[model samples]
Structure formats: C-alpha cells, structure tokens
Target: MRRMIFRRELKSNARGLVIWSLVLGGLVLMMMSVYPSFAEDAQTAEEMLNVFPEPLAKVFGMDTLNLGTYTGFYGVEVHLINTLVGSVYAALLAAGMLAKEENDHTAEFLLSKPVTRIEVTGQKLAAVLTNLFMLNAVIAAVSFACTGFADEAVELDILVWYLLATFLLHVTVASVSFLLSAVMRRTRSIVSLALGIVFLSYALHIMAGLSDRFDFLRHVSLFSFTDAAAIVENGGLDAPCAAVMVLVSLLCALGAIGYYHNKDITG
Candidate 1:
C-alpha cells in the first residue's frame, strides 16, 4: 500500500514537477544569456547600482558583493530569483499534496482502501521530498551548465554549496506548508496562503538586511538562511542557519504526520 500510494502520488504530480523544473531552468538560461552583455559594462552596472539608496542596495545584496564578478552577479541576480520562485513552488506543491485529496473529494476513496492514515501521510510526504529533490537537481544541473558556458571563472564548490542551501530552503518551506495542509480545512485553492507565507518570509529577510531593529528576523526567515550573497561569500551555509533549517523541517514534518494521523477525513 505504501509503495502504491507513493507511486500514485508521484505519477499524479509528475506534470507539475516537469513544469516547475522547466520554468526554473528556463529562467536561469534566459538570465545567464545576458551575462555577457552585463559583464562588458560591469563597471557601469556597478555605478548604477551604487546610486540606489543604501538600504535598498543592501536589501538586494549590492552591499557586499561586486556585480562585475560572476559569483557576485549570480548571487545578486540568478540566485535570488531561484530561491524566491523555488520557495513559492515548494510551498504551493506541499500545500496541495495531501489536502487536495480531501479538496477533490477523493479522501473518502483513499481512506476506504486497505491503508492506514499513517501510510497515506508518509507516502505523500515521501513524494513531496522526491519531487523537491528532482526539482533542485534539475536546477543545479542547469545552473552548472550555464556557469560553464559563461566566460567568467566560477567556483564549482561554491556553486554546489549554493545549490545545497537552496534545497534546504525548499525543504524548510515545504515542511511548513505540509503541516498547514494537514490542519487547514478542505479548500480548492490554498495557493493564496502558500504564496503569502513565501512572500512574508521574503519580506522579513529584506527587513533583516535593511535595519538592525529587525535583525532578529534573519534567524526567523528561511530566505536569510539561504541568502545567495552570504553563500557566495562564505562558500556555504552557516552552521546555525543549517541547523535551524534542518530543525524546522523536522519539527514541521513530524507535526504534519502527527496531526494527519488522527484527523477525520470526509468526502
């Protein structure tokens, strides 16, 4: 039953997986295609960035990273889009996984099978992890390929670390949405809620960069944990941020399983 459920979930969500992977990869390709033009006028670009308000520049990672270098340019541009849109993808995917069974009036059919709620939840969670893994894997491969074609020298090791941090970010956000799916009432569209969560977290991350008063938001926002600028500069995720991402994912996933196990399901 577990195997069946896992396979079914994967099959049902396969199109979404493909679409998201293509969208993300396409964006990376489109953006990297412009790197040559930008690199030629890197000095002018840096000068233009400097004219922006200090806080605004800091919020977008123009504060510490040089736009001329590929790594810095990637951190400020490609990586930011990757994390932001990737997080939204994670949230929306997770929000629908289990809850859609109920929202689609298929919960009763699933529950009638020779399967326990635990099996259903566990299988669905497994599917979510697999989907996220595949998406990130595609993104990483595309990113590496793009970097290879660029004229600038990029640190492959740092790119690997950045990709890993992005995977962690996706998992953290997915876990949270998975829990919400387990607890929220059946609904056809949880899209708004999922998008709200991602944007709010992004806002917090921006605030953390913009003001010392909100500096603590750095710890609260998953975006901060996976900051492209920081990853490019430090060569990897910080110990504390990695720990927090792992801890949050674990806690939320466990909570989702627990709550979903006993919650009543209706057609």
Candidate 2:
C-alpha cells in the first residue's frame, strides 16, 4: 500500500516535474552560455556595474562583481535566479501535491481507503522529496555542463558546494510549503500563500542588503542564508546556515505529519 501510494503520487506529478526541470535547466544553460562573452571584456563589464548606486549594486549582488572568473560571474548572474526559480518550483510542487486532492474533491475517497493519514502523508512527502531531488539533479547537471562554455576553467569544488547549498535551500522552502498544504484546505490559497512567503522572504533579503537598518532581516530570510556571493567567497557551505535549513525542514515535516494525521478530511 505504501509503495502503491508513492508510485501513484509520482506518476500523477511526473509531467509537472519534468516541465519545471526543463525550464530551470534551460535558464541555467542560457545564463552560463553568456559567461564567455562577459569574460572577454571583464573590465568593461565591471566598470558598467560600478555606475550603479552602492545600495542598488548591493541589492543586485553587484558589490562583489568579478566577471573575469567563472565562479564570480556565475555568482552574480545565475545563482540568484536559479535560487528563486528553484524555490518557487519546490513550493508550488509541495503545496499542490496534497492540497489538490482536497480541492478536486478526491480526498474523501482517498482517505476512505485502507491507507491511514500518516501513510498518505508519508507517501506524498516521499514523492515530493523525489521530485525535488530529480529537479535539482537535472539543473545541477546542466549547470556543470554549461561551465565548459566559460573561457577559464570553473572551480569544481566551489560549484559543487554551491549546488548543494541551493538544494538544501529548496528542501527547506518545500518543507514549509508542505506544512502549509497540510494546514490549508484549498489548493489556490495554499499556492498563493506559498508564493507570498517566497517573495516576502526575497524582499527581506533585498532590504537587508540595502541597509544595515534591515540587517537583522537577514536572519529570517532564507535567501540571506544561501547568498551565492558569500558561498563563493567562503569556498564552501555555510555550516550554520545549512544546519538551520536542515532543522527547519525537519520541523516542518514533523508538523505536517502531526497536523495531517489529525485533520478532518471531508468532501
């Protein structure tokens, strides 16, 4: 029964998963392809970035612009977009998985089966993790392959760490969205609220960079914890930030399980 539920969820969500993976992978490839051209006239590109106001530069992650190298250019150009898109994909997938059952008026029938709520939640969560894992794996492979387009050799170690941090960040966001899905009764509300949380977190990250007055917001925004510039400069995963993501993901999963196990699902 557990395997059946897992396979069913995976099959149901496969098309959406494949579409997101291709979209994200194509975006990463397109962005990485532009790196060689920028590297050719790195100084001019850097000077162009210098014309922006300091706060604006910081908000766009141009404060540490170094286009001469692959890692630096990727950090500036590709990382944030990749993070944003990947996080949104994760949130949407997680929220939709459970909530759709309720919204489509299928939950009553599903729950009437021999499956317990815990089993349903566990199977669905497994499917969510599997889809997230597949999405990240595809995009990471695309990003790694696209590095070959750069003039200089990219640092494989830092690239690996950056990708790992990005994956963890997606997991954290997806777990939170999953928790919301378990609590919310409507699919539309779940997706809307999930996206709202993502954009708000991103806004906080931008605000944190804009001024020290909002520096404290960094602690709350997941974006700050996964800052690409910081990851590239540090040359490894941020241990404290990674730990926080893992902790939050675990807690959210536990909360989702508890709530879903007790909730009344009626059509």
Candidate 3:
C-alpha cells in the first residue's frame, strides 16, 4: 500500500518534473554558452556595469563578484535563475502534492483503503523529496556539462557549494509549501500562495541589498542562503543560514504531517 501511494504520486508528478528540469536546464545551457564572448572584454563589461547605480549593482551581486571570472559571471546570471525559477517549481510541486487529492475528489477513495493518514502523509512526503532530488540532479548535471563546454578551470568546490545551496533552498521552500497544502482545501489558492512566498522572499532579498536599513531582512530570505557571490567568497554556505534552512524544513514537514493527520478531507 505504501509503495502504491508513493508510485502513484511520482507518476502523477512525472510530467511536471520533466518540464521543469528541461526549462531550467535550457536556461543554464543558453547562459553558459555565451560565457566565452562575455569574458573576452571583461574589463569593458565591468566598466559598463559600474556606470549603473550602486544599489542596482548590490541587487545583482555585481559588487562582490568580478565580471572577469567564470563563477562570478555565473553568480550574477545563471545562479539567480536557478534559485528563483527553481523555487517556483519547488513551491508548486509541494503545494499541489497533497491538496490535489482532495481537489480531484480522490481523497475519499484514497482514504477508504487500508492506508492510515500517517502512511499517506509519509508516502506523499517521500514523493515530494524524490521529485525535488531528481530536479536538482538534472540541473546539476546540466550545469557541470555547460561548465565543461565553456572550457574554463572553474572552482569545483564553489560550484558544489552553490549546487548544495540550491538543493537546500528548494527543500526549505517546498517543506513550507507542503505544510500549506495540508491546510488548504483547493488547489487554486495553494498555488497562488506558494508562488507568493517565492516572489515575496525574492523581494525581501532585493530590499536587503538595496539599503543598509533592510540588511536584517537577509536572515529572513531563503535566497540569501543561496547567494552565489557569498557562496563563492566563503567557499561554502553560511553555517547559521544553513542551519536555519534545515531547522525550518524539518519543522514545516513535521507540522504538515501533524496537521494532515487531522485534516478533514472534503472528498
């Protein structure tokens, strides 16, 4: 029964997983392909970028990373897309995972079986983690391949840390969305609210960069945990931020399990 539920969720989510992976991979490939040209006149590019306002530079992480290096350019370009777009995918995947059962009027049928609510929750959460893991796997492979094609001796340690941060970012956001899925009855608001979290977190990150007054907002933004420039500079994630990610993800997932066990499914 557990295997059945897990497989069913995976099968249902397969199409979305493939579509998201392809979209993210395509973007990474396109950005990395032009790195050679972008690196040719790096000084000119840096000077051109400098002419822009300081706040704008901070927002894009231009202040910390040099335009001349591969990782720096990647931090500004590809990293942003990976975290932002990937978070959207993560939020939607998790937000819909459990709620869709009720929205599709399949909850009654599912619960009618011998499965306990705990089993159902466990199996569904497993499916969510599996999907998130697979999505990151595909993106990481594509990123590494693109790096190879660019023929640059990039810092593998930094890249590894960046990928780790990306995965953690997805897990953290998805866990929160998973908790929301347990509370919501319909799929409509689940999606809207999930995307809202992603965009709002991004807005907070930008605000933090745009002024000193909002610097504390960095601690509240998941995007800050995955900041490419900071990752490159430190050679890894910030211990405190990473701990928060782990702690938040765990609490939200456990909360989802608890709430879902008592949730009154309409269907």
Cα lDDT, all candidates: 0.85, 0.87, 0.89
* Error of model 2, residue 225, in angstroms: 0.7
Candidate 2, position 254, lDDT:
94
The regions of model 2 sitting more than 4 angstroms off are none
Query: Model 3: residues >4 Å from true position, as ranges?
Result: none
Ranking by lDDT: 3, 2, 1
> How does each model score on TM-score?
0.94, 0.96, 0.96
Better of 2 and 3 by TM-score: 3
User: On a 0 to 1 TM-score scale, where does candidate 2 land against the true structure?
Assistant: 0.96
How well is each residue in 116-210 modelled by candidate 3, as lDDT tens digits? 99899889989999999999998899888877645558877877888889999999999999999998888889999999999999999999999
Scored by lDDT, the top model is: 3
lDDT of 1: 0.85
Ranking by TM-score: 3, 2, 1
> Which residue pairs come into collision in candidate 1?
none
Which 10-residue window of candidate 2 scores lowest in summed lDDT? Answer: 59-68
Clashes of each: 0, 0, 0
Clashing pairs in 3: none
